[model samples]
Target: MLDKDATEFDGACHCGAVRFHVRLSEGLHSARRCTCSLCRMRGAVAVTARLGDLHMLAGQEMLTLYQFNTGTAKHYFCSRCGIYTHHQRRSDPSQYGVNTACLEGVSPFDFEDVPVTDGVNHPSDGNGQKGDGIIGVLRFQSVGC
Candidate 1:
């Protein structure tokens, strides 16, 4: 459901060790903060796109993947600089959630009406188990980028 006229945005890490381009619709330019344990600790703002819409223009070798808890979601970062760039969310593995802060020439959007999803109580492995015993809790805050 993306507009045909969506533009490509340039982005990089704080230390310039990583860089990439993301094509996104204007409607999706806003940042999203998820209440997940690792996301809260890293202060990540997710700007999502379908897997086909994202491309890593550079720094592929510098990226490292981190997974914990249920180990379904993979958080990618710059190994040399420790800058989180994107992640594969457990809720939807088909989409890549890029960190909005890493995108250049964009500002954080006001999330007054954005719904906060609860991942803390997610069913383990899509099974009927009460819990898998891996608890990951998170909360988010936004500021000017």
Candidate 2:
């Protein structure tokens, strides 16, 4: 059972072919971005969540997993729509990083001053860098209006 006060949010692909529900604390939904090669190419803005907080509301069969860079993280996408929905972050296997853009009500445009993290120097142990640990927060503002 999910906490009654938890912030329940919805998200989907650009073509609306994929959708999911995410339950997280209000302030906990802040976005993050990774500098890894794959993450850079995908332009993904991540919101961390506990594994159990994420629920595949629909289109389970359409989802596909992509693994690379030592196979540390499992990037999940909609196979049919080719949308990166979420991923099991390499830095923390126990957490799920959902794409904030995929969420329904939350527009990337509304975020202000998303923090930047340094992942290029990330720890080689596959745990990612130590200081603050996050590589960056690619908010809508950073992407341009």
Candidate 3:
């Protein structure tokens, strides 16, 4: 949930062809993963952003869109580098699930653990329980520095 004190971040695609600015809905605490078919294959950690919070800075034409299943979620990636940048969430059309990796100085590995949503049985698909929707958590244990 973005408050008046929300901090803005600059982000770009791996190839630097696409750039954007965003204000997360809950800072980095919003980090999460999904268990849907597409999400499972992409394996990206996402943070929430309201539709009005994401502002494309440059190379909008270099971005590609991909959709599947219900096609309600609009996934955007950099065409030059094949990097997933963000997606309009299917369960919540008013928000986008921004790729944490796209943010400058950020990496998915930076999170020690992330909540995994039950996207496989999404509530929008008329299955599973409403609210939270968390099915599990993913933890990363580093061996050495």
Candidate 4:
């Protein structure tokens, strides 16, 4: 059952091979970018959503999962287009970190001051390795629009 009051945002992979709708639990206030080796390379802004808040409207088969390190985190992407869509956060299993850029009419650059999570020293790693702790929030404004 879908919540009538929930805000719905349409999303699709780069090649339109995968599509889905995100019914935000509380709008989109929880967007952030991670600074982990994998995340930094991927370079995508993720917003918080409960596992139930996300609904796969189509292309479930085109989605592929990838895990690394301790395999605690599950990353999902479109197998056809190779576009990362979302992932289950290792820090909070209950939260699904969604690719903010996938949202319709939304661009990572449109966001101002996005907080950076210190994945380099994740508590789950227990490696005693630590990042500077939230390097900073990035701010950007789309130009010529």
Candidate 5:
């Protein structure tokens, strides 16, 4: 988990075509994964950030946007390296789900446990409330160096 005080982080794409700084809404405590079609395929752990909290520092033009299904969520990636960086949440339009691997000094494996949400039957889709859609938890265990 990230230090509670560590709200901000610098991030970049795999090819360095995109760079950004983000201030997490609740640091790594908001880390989660989604079982949605796109998310399941992307297989990324994400932390929450307010829409305005993410600031592009460079290579804005190198970023590409992808939206599908309901088209409420807007996924951004690096055009050069095709690295998913962030996405405006479909459940919460006010927030962005930032890829943990894109952040400096942070990796998906850094989290011992992360909640997995059921995006398939999303609350916004009239399935149920947000927390009620929790699928399960993903745990990471490091054995040896």
Candidate 6:
């Protein structure tokens, strides 16, 4: 079972141009991989945080935002170094999926069986197939918000 508790964590981009602090309330229990057109390319494992759980400690000016498709999910990255930092989940606007590999002392493998979701058939798009034939979807069950 997950710890289901909150703790402070810190992280930054490759060039350290962007830095931020996030509270890991679920301790990567909600960690996952996404296969949206962009996520499939970026290939980063991510964990969840409430909007307030993230605080830009530095380099806010150096952060860039990219929106595509429906434009609901906003992807943020370090403008200076082009490292994806986090994204405002289209699945859940109130929560951000901070990059798991970017966390200060945590590894994506530290969590048991990280799951991947099928963004290509997202429920948000009105026809999600809850794993269908995807690999990691069996573990996650649904592309949850």
| TM-score per candidate, chains pooled | 0.72, 0.80, 0.93, 0.86, 0.95, 0.83
Range of the 10 consecutive residues with the lowest summed lDDT in candidate 5: 126-135
Evaluate residue 114 in candidate 2 and report its C-alpha lDDT on the 0 to 100 scale: 58
Against the true structure, candidate 4 reaches a TM-score of: 0.86
Better of 1 and 4 by TM-score: 4
lDDT of 3: 0.90
What TM-score does prediction 6 earn? 0.83
lDDT of 6 at 52: 90
Ranking by TM-score: 5, 3, 4, 6, 2, 1
lDDT of 4 by residue, 82-137 (tens): 99999998988898888978888777876667888788888787856466457678
Candidate 1 lDDT tens digits, 116-142: 444555554554435432343333355
What TM-score quantifies how close candidate 1 is to the native fold? 0.72
lDDT string for model 2 (66-138, tens) is 9976788898888877989999877678888888778776655556645555656667665545667664454
Clashes of 5: 0
Q: Lowest-lDDT window of 10 residues in candidate 2?
A: 136-145
For model 5 the local lDDT of residue 29 reads: 86
Off by over 4 Å in 6: 1-6, 109-112, 128-145
Better of 3 and 5 by lDDT: 5
Expressed as tens digits, the lDDT of each residue in 1-145 for candidate 6 is 3343546789999898899999865767677887889988997888889999899999999989999999999999999889999999998899999997777877655565667788888877778466442446423333444
Which residue pairs collide, candidate 6? none
Q: Against the unseen true structure, what C-alpha lDDT does each candidate score? A: 0.67, 0.72, 0.90, 0.82, 0.92, 0.81
- Candidates sorted by lDDT, descending order? 5, 3, 4, 6, 2, 1
For candidate 4, the per-residue lDDT at 139 reads: 79
Candidate 5 C-alpha error for residue 139, in Å: 0.9
Error of 3 at 9 (Å): 0.9
The residue ranges of model 2 lying beyond 4 angstroms of the native Cα positions read 1-6, 25-29, 124-128, 134-145
